[model samples]
Target: MASPIKLHQLRAFVEVTRQGSIRAAARLLSLSQPALTKAIKELEEGLGARLFIRHRQGVQLTECGEAFFRHASLILEELRAAQEDIQQRLGNIGGRVSIGVGASVARTIMPEVITRFHRAYPHVKVRVLEGQLVSMIPELRQGELDFTINTYYHASFDNELLYEKLMEKEYRVVGRCGHPCAGARTLQELMQCDWTLPTPRGSYYKQLVDLFVSLGVMPTVSVTCETFMSSTSLLAKSDFLSILPRDVIEDPILGQQLMAFDLDLPLPRATFYLIQRKETALTPMSAHLANLFRQHCRASA
Candidate 1:
């Protein structure tokens, strides 16, 4: 049987179609114009079809080329998927996986997750990017990161992204060990004090905001911090108050240094969710790391 057409031909075709000029495509592909022309001629001969029209203005794809372009994109994507699958199968889970996590998850949960993951698969390298929910989905879509842990809501990529509920925890009003809000009796009473809050884009923070709106009052935010660590750290040293999940307050390191105040009205309950790219298959290492994260969250609960 004749050998399959070279990937170089497909690459050349894709570049030429995108660039819209053989000379431009040749420059983009780092090939001489004549060499590129020969490659395209050979490809069209093998395929038994004309793929492009040469013009003084620029090249235009033939009807067949348009269809071919669509197939070529799918082929390249599948090739990537296959490469990742093989790497996983070979048990070479040493490649980098970029993950995004909310500030709270990074502070309260990721330490244990990372430690256990590394212990089991020391070869795999993990890079965790901490950011708000607003940026997480965009970053994931851009292929800048693999997955993230955030609150599950209506998402544009809901069909292609998996959101797994990790756990549920209640909110607590917390302040520095010496802050006065630590002794406040009710929402009305606590409202009298200054507060630190995570940005409204934060899933929990949104709930916090809605809870106040429902109560016919909006709590005044004294300061806004980007991450839980920064917000909590600020609460540790200042008289400012912040609302946090019960799990974070219950954490030994943070719990010992902060105090939770009683509130007259109940705060909204928050559910934590783990967001990941939908995968029919993943590298052996990525699957293991994901499993490790789930296992650890279960253990913590």
Candidate 2:
């Protein structure tokens, strides 16, 4: 039988894993090196595994340690969240909620959502992480982000995430007001024009590329921009085209310079969701933010 793990052992394990050295972890934890080492030793013994292996530089997590670290770190975060939740219930509302937002929701609803959130939780800090869903998954699994409000593409689903579908957003081939392909109605016609595709290699970009390849299209992808803002700017000034949800082209500010052109071809439709780790129950602060996002998406739809 394995020894029962204690909170002290977990804290010690997580810190040591983070600091990459026992001495540094001990300093951060305000404990002596021997105590930290003993805690780590006991943690490894309890789990019946060698958590770390030492080399000339420092300690590195073994394969087992790496797996344990994921759960251990999240356990610590959950405990912190629980303590904060109780404090907030007792009228102390002063914790941060970190979240990820894709362009679909952020472009139209973010300002209003933030305004509403600030009015209710004036003391709580809100951290908004911007990127495509593919880029933010690791953080979600690691509990760095409380949750995400974003659109889902074909490859965006993960076994570790619980996805609550919000709404389906039809996509269109978007272009500048005077784009040569502005009146284009076919994929082949749009393929002749330059495009500003997503820069992220693994997620949306790869999937888009895959779609293009499957359809016998090698779009004249002239430029690749990472953020929607940059790509929107690039699209507004040039003849470059991109596939965007209708709301982006219909955005009050962006609409001045952009318009969506229909195609006989069917574009990939986007479905937005409230995405979170399967085991993570969002703290009240974050849950409220997620609710605000859902409300906004519904109202807009």
Best by TM-score: 2
TM-score of 1: 0.70
Scored by CA lDDT, what does every candidate get?
0.75, 0.83
TM-scores, each model vs. reference: 0.70, 0.81
Error of 1 at 163 (Å): 1.5
lDDT of 1 by residue, 1-301 (tens): 3336888888888889879899899998899999899988888888888999889987999999988876774455446556766886786566656678777688778888889888876876788988766667755544446567777545466787777887766788888787755556778777767788867874777777777888777778978887777888888888888888777788888877888887776777777777765663445665666777778778877
lDDT of 1: 0.75
lDDT of 2 by residue, 31-58 (tens): 9999999999988889999999988677
| 10: Cα error in model 2, Å | 2.2
Candidate No. with top lDDT: 2
Cα deviation of 277, candidate 1, in Å:
3.3
Error of 1 at 110 (Å): 1.4
